[model samples]
Target chain A: MFPTPVEKRSRAAQITYQSLVPLALILWLLPLIAVALFSIRPGVDFANGNYWGVPSSFELFTNYGRVFFESDMPRYLWNSVLITVPTVIGAVALSCMTGFALGIYRFRGNLLIFFMFIAGNFVPFQILMVPVRDLTVDVGLYNTKMGLVLFHIAFQTGFCTLFMRNFIRALPYELIEAARVEGVKEWRIFWYIVLPLMKPAIAALSVLVFTFIWNDYFWAVVLTQGPDAQPVTAGITSFNSQFVAQYHLMSAGSIVAALPPVLMFFLMQRHFIAGLTLGAVK
Target chain B: MTLPTDPPTQTWLQRHRMIITPLMFLLPGVAFFAVYVISPILQSFYISTFEWTGLGSLSEQGEFIGMQNYRELMSDRNFEVSLWNNVKWLVLYLLAIPGGLFIALFLNQTVAGIRVYKSLFFFPFVISQVVVGLVFSWFYLPNVGLLNVVLGWFGSEVNILGNPDLATYGIIAAGLWPQTAYCMILYLTGLNAVDPEQIEAARLDGAKGVRMLWHVILPQLRPATFIAFVVTIIGALRSFDLISVMTNGGPFGSTRVLSFYMFEKALSEYGFRMGYGSAIAVILFLIMLIFISYFLWTMWRDERAARL
Candidate 1:
């Protein structure tokens, strides 16, 4: 809006702007477009040095079938689902209560506790890598999906709590006050009043945390090793190594690895954007 | 009105509900956070003082060689390269802010299919960085790679990731793909919330193009810009996945940022020197702490303003 609408410009200018938009988008997404192209080409295309030519034959089904059936990709994808879903549920449930507590109540250390979560969320993962891995190993959860899930739930709660608390703070205070005046129990107030209103936030966070945990490669690499517990992001590396130089297969594998979060984003675009742009609009 | 509420079990909960309710709610989250997030930070600092291969128990295997690892970091050439690359990353990665703003301004329209276009435009940010790295590596692949084929039209070519001098820049370019998209979405959202009346007023005074953007538009976009800046900086520092997948700190280890370097020094491939890795991690932590403190300070100020 600040740049003035293209409709306000000359007819030629409007047409030019419209044409340029797609051109710019194509250029911006060229690399991904190439991969999308690569994923569908026959395995012989790379060996034939026909990288950019139109695919002689579509091997979308064949390549993807190999990824799914001939490899550990399914195991890794399952591991990712296993790791991500629990983290989303655990983090969201924990943060809902924490957010309610921090947002609704006025008490000493409230701001301090909130800031601690804030600070912890921003600390680089490298710092946490050694100790968190050690902690997981010592607890005998090492190399297990449960280990990864538990760490994720804890680490993600930091950000989730920050988001939830701010969202809870924005809710009407009068509703809570009225409930208090009615002598309703605090837990019931949270359940019947606050929890119902937190639906949008919860939905937004679930999609967000799903993408985050699903795409997580660092902790997956550190806490787990084999396909037994490794998520797809890390598993994709082994997938690449296994099908080394088989561009079609590797491209297919990469797309498969990156699919869930991309699907999540497209389906939940509104909530995903809302969750991401939380503080952007003031 | 109070008579029906005087149940026997209601005495304690009613008397101190405010204090107790919050405490009850906070315990699980805090306990988990403390064990997983907080205490480990302290433990890392302690671990940095000892030499251990990350085998056996820490108390028995670790020899307390205080400050030796830090001393080694001072002379370590790989550490030096990694540190410089991180500086380069911090500087170059910020270009995404302006790049995103340019695209966001271009796309902030009501044209037909614009929503689909915007989503397609933002597609990169949603995909995992690992995939992005793999995609870019293929894009930069020598001989028959897309880049070389394109460059052949001009009869000029260069191997990007295979060259030591250019490899870090190549990886940074790949990272900017998604980072710019992220910033673009933020700016688009910010632009939606911009005041039309203010824009009209500025137009009346004959401000358009860069003048209007500099004077009227950007001031209103401060919140979005702050978020963009914070995320870009953080993302720049947390750039392990791209390096790992693309070059694996290759072309003579020229692409190692501190994050990747720490992992290389401390864990996989290299034998585990937990002490050395923790030392490197501590430095990265300290560097990040500077920005984290500033971010918290700004957020705290906003919180106070909102509370009052």
Candidate 2:
């Protein structure tokens, strides 16, 4: 609206705008398109430097089969799922209760607590690296999926609390007040009254958190030792190093590693964008 | 102002008892913050003073070295290089904003498959950075790479990733894929909320092209710009994955940023120097603190104004 709609522009200008769209999009997504092309090409074609040319043969299934059968990719994929699912459920559940409290109540040090969460959310992971690793070890959760989940849930709560609190704050306060006045009790006010209204926020956070924990490479390396527990993002890096000049297989592995989050984003693109742009427009 | 016909407001507040209500809500979040977030910060600050390598017996005895790590960093050329590269990254990473905005503006047109265009453009962000790194690495592959293939048409045979001068730029380009998508999404949301009447009024006043955008558009895009700026800075500073993937800060450590350097110092086969790594991390933390404080101050002002 601020730039003025294309329909209102001069005919020449509208024509220029329409012509540039595909060219720009092509340039923008060149990397992804190239990779997609590489994934389906036969290995012999990649070796001969005929990568961009038409694949001599489509060996998509064979390449994909090599990735799964020859590698510990299934285990890695399972580990990623094991880590991501728990982190999402734990982080969202914890933040819901915390967000509800911060939004609905006004007590001493409320602002202080809120500011602390905001500040914590921004700090680099390095600052927490040593302590968190040590704590995980002490608890006997190191090198396991549960360790990653616990840390992610604990850390993600900072951002989720901010999101949930801000969302709950924007809701009509009178609804909660009326429920409370009717002797519905504070807990029921949360369960029946407030919880039902947070569907959009919950959906948004779930998709965002799913992508985040799934793609987490840093913690995957630090906490876990090998393919037995490592997530696919970190697994792909190790696999790439081993495969070395096996470019076709490496491309196939990369695509496999990237599939889950891409699927989630496409399926829930709206909620994911909503969650990501939390404070962007506000 | 009309007075409430019911009992005074104090009675209602007393029944709720302001003291207990917020405390109940604040406790779990506060306790979690104290245990996981706040305490670790203090712990890291304390660990920075010691000479401990995370292995072996704690009783193996690491003498307390006060500020030795920071002093070593002062004389360390690699650390200096990494720090300078971080400065470069912070500056160059801002390109995502204008790049994203241009794409958003281009795609803002209503068309037959604009939705597909938006998603495909956003496809980069959905994939992991690891895959992004692999994709770009292939794109920059000397003779077989797409870039080389395209360049070969013009009779240019340059190795972009292997050349030290071009290596950092190549890695930064990979970083931009997701960063640009992120910024484009933010701008799209901001554009959605722009007041329509003002655009019509400006157009009627002979404001078209750059004048319309420069005056009427950019001011309303402030919120999105602020967020873009913050995320870009953080993304630049936090660029460990791509560097690790594309170059591994290699070819004589030309692409080493603070984050990767810290990792090398702490955990690489060259031996674990947790003390030195913590020092580098502390510096990164301080630099980030400047941006974080500015953001917090701005948000506080906005929140306060909203409350009024």
Candidate 3:
């Protein structure tokens, strides 16, 4: 609206605007588009210096099929699903109760506790690296999916609590008050009342957390070592090494590693953006 | 025991529910955060005070070498380079804000297929940074990639990632690809909620284009800008993924930020000096704390206003 909609402008301007949007989009995503193009080509194309030419033969399925059948790609993908799903459920579950308490109550240190989660949320992962890794090893959970999942759930709760608290704060307090007047038990009120109102937040946070945990490379590199537990984000490094300079297969592997989250973003664009913007300042 | 009409007595759980309920609800979340997040921060500080290889428990095997790691950091040349590169990253990464706003404004229209266009523009952000690094690494390939191809038309060629002087910038450019997309999405969402009435009022007063943007539009997009600032600052600091995937902090070790440097010291094949890594982490933490305090201050002010 601030730019003044194209419809309100001259016909030439409108036509220019329409063409410009796609042009800009093309330029913006050109790098990714190049990778997508590479994923479908034969490996020999690179051997002959055909880096940017039309593919001589399409090997889309063949290249992707090698990634699936001839490697540990599936195992890593499974590990990622195992790691991501539990973290989402655990973090969201914990935050719901935390958010409920922080949003509804006026207890001592409420703001302090709320700010602690927020501040923790912002702390660089480097600061926690040595200690967390040591802690994981000490518990003998190193190289295990459970250890990674535990750390992720704990770490993600910080942001999830912040998000969920803000959302729950926006819910009508009168609804809780009216329920209290009926002498409904407190936890029951949370279960039968507030949790139901939190469906959208849960959906948004779940998808956001899923994408985050899936794309997580640092912890996957640190806490887990082998393909047994490494997610695709980290495993793709070895995948690249195994097929070194085989750009066709490497591109396919990278695309496969990136696809789940891209799909999540596309499938849930509204909720994903809502989760991100957080509407913090205004 | 009294007559049937007598009121039921309040159980202790029911009577003290106000204090107890929130406490109960907060317990698990607070516990997890304290153990995994809060306690580790304090532990990092403690660990920074000792010399440990991280083979055994810190208290038993670690020697009390107070301030030694920090002293080493002061003299370490790699640390010096990393610190400077971090400064470069912090300054340049913010270009994404204006870059994103420009793209957002350009795309902020009701044209045909605009939704698909916007989503496609935001495509880079949804994927992992490793892939972004790979994409850009290939994009900057010496003679054959898109960047060199474009430059070839002008008869100039530079090996970007292979050059020590240019590698960090190349990686930062890779970083900006996604960071800009992130900021663009934020602004697009912010722009959607901008008050059209205020724009109509301004248009009557003859404020248009850049003048209108500076006066009316940007002020409304404050929240988006704040978020963009927060994420970009954090992203700039947490720039390990691209560095690891693309350069591995090489080209004469020119691209290491404190985060990557810390990891190299604490882990990797460099022999684990847990204390030294924690020391570097502590420094990064202190830098981050400055921004964290300012953000928390602003949010506190907002929360206070909302309370009344």
Candidate 4:
């Protein structure tokens, strides 16, 4: 709207703008396009030096089958789900109360506590790595998916609290005050009142936390060692090492590793953007 | 007087409800956060002063080398390179803001199926970085990579990823895919918020094209730009996956960043030097702290002023 719609521009300018869009998108996505192409390429081409040439046949199913049959990819996917779903539920649940307490209750250290969550959200993960790993080992949860999930729920609570607090603060206080005047207990006021109204925030955070934990390569590698506990992202890394230069197979594995989050994003695009653009417009 | 629909007698369970109810809702989450989140931060500070590998008992004998790891890192060349790569990443990664803005402007039109195109354009960000790195690695493969093939048509066959000089940039390019998409979304939201009245006012003043964009649109886009800047900076500094997947600080370790180097020192191919790694982590943490404090300070001041 700011640049004046295409019809407002000259015919030549309109054609140029239209033509540039696809060209730019193609150039922008060249890497993904190439991998998508390669994943379907026949395995025979691996020896023929035809890696870049157009595929002679599509064998994506066979390559995918090999990844499933020969690798621990399924286990990795399950681990990712195990870690991600709990973290999402845990983080969101914790943050909702934290957010409400910080946003609604004008108590001492409220801003300070809010800022703690904010600062905690930004701290480098490395600082947390050594000690977190040590603690996990000490608690006898080392190399277990539970170790990673417990850490994730906590770490993610920082950001999720930041988001939830801001969102809850933006909600009108009058509704809560009106309920309070009726002598409604604060807990019921939250549960029967505020909790149901927070669906949008919960939805946004779910999609966000899902993606963050799913694509979490750093923590996965650091906390978990092998197929027993490794998530898909780390699984893909091992797969890459084992299938080195087996481009088709690697491509197929990459696609599989990337599928769940990509599908989540597409399905929940609105919620994803809503969560991401939290303070962008303000 | 208002009449109650039910008997007003207090039940035995209702006496201390205020204290118990919130506690019941809050206990589990708070316990998880404390055990997993809050305590580890304190422990990291404590662990930074001593030596320990990731396995076995910490009491088994770690030399208490106070600040030696940090002191040693101060003189280490690899640490310096890693630090420099982080600086490079911080700078170049910001290109996503303008890159995204340009794409957002281009696609702001209401062409047929533009919604589909916008989603497709944003596809890169939705996928995991592991996949993006793998894709780009193929795109930059020595002979058969599509990038080299495209360059071949122009009579040049350069192996971007194989060259130590260009490998970091190659990975950075891959990183830009998602980063640019993120920025595009921010700008799209900003564009939606731009006041039509101001643009109509500017158009009446004969402002158009670059002049309009510079004078009218950009100022309105300030909030989005700031968010874009913050996310881009944080994302750049936090870059680990793409580098790990694409180059692994390879071709003579030209692509090492502080984060990756910290992981390498703490865990992977390099031996587990937990104390040394924590020391490096401290340095990275301190660097990030500078930005974090600045962001918090600015936001704090803004929030306070807004309340006034």
Tens digit per residue, CA lDDT, model 2, B140-218: 8888888888999999988877988889988998998899998998898888888889988888899988888889988
Give the Å shift of residue B269 in candidate 3: 0.9
User: Model 2: per-residue lDDT, tens digit, A1-282?
Assistant: 655567877999888877777888888888777887887888789678787877899988998999999998888999999999999998898888889888888767677777778888888877777777777788888899888888888889999999999999989999987765665667778889888999999999999999988988878877888888899998997787777787778888999999999999999999998998888776
Q: Model 3, A85-143: lDDT tens per residue?
A: 99999999999999999999998999999999999999999999999999999999999
What proportion of the real contacts between chains A and B does each prediction keep? 0.81, 0.60, 0.74, 0.64
Interface C-alpha RMSD after superposing true interface residues, each candidate, one decimal: 1.7, 2.1, 2.6, 2.6
Better of 1 and 2 by lDDT: 1
- Sort order, lDDT high to low: 1, 3, 4, 2
Clashes of each: 0, 0, 0, 0
Instruction: List TM-scores for all candidates, in order.
Output: 0.98, 0.95, 0.98, 0.94
DockQ of each: 0.74, 0.60, 0.65, 0.57
Off by over 4 Å in 4: B1-31
Clashing pairs in 4: none
- lDDT scores for all predictions? 0.93, 0.84, 0.93, 0.85
* TM-score for candidate 1: 0.98
**Of 3 and 4, which scores higher on lDDT?**
3
- What's the C-alpha lDDT at position B100 in model 1? 92
**lDDT string, candidate 3, B1-308, tens digits:** 22233247877877789989999999999999999999999999999999999988998999989999999999999999999999999999999999999999988988778898888888788899988999899889889888898899999999999999999999999999999999999999899989999999999999998999999999999989998999999899989999999999998999999999999999999989999999999999999999999999988998999989
Over 4 Å off, model 1: B1-10
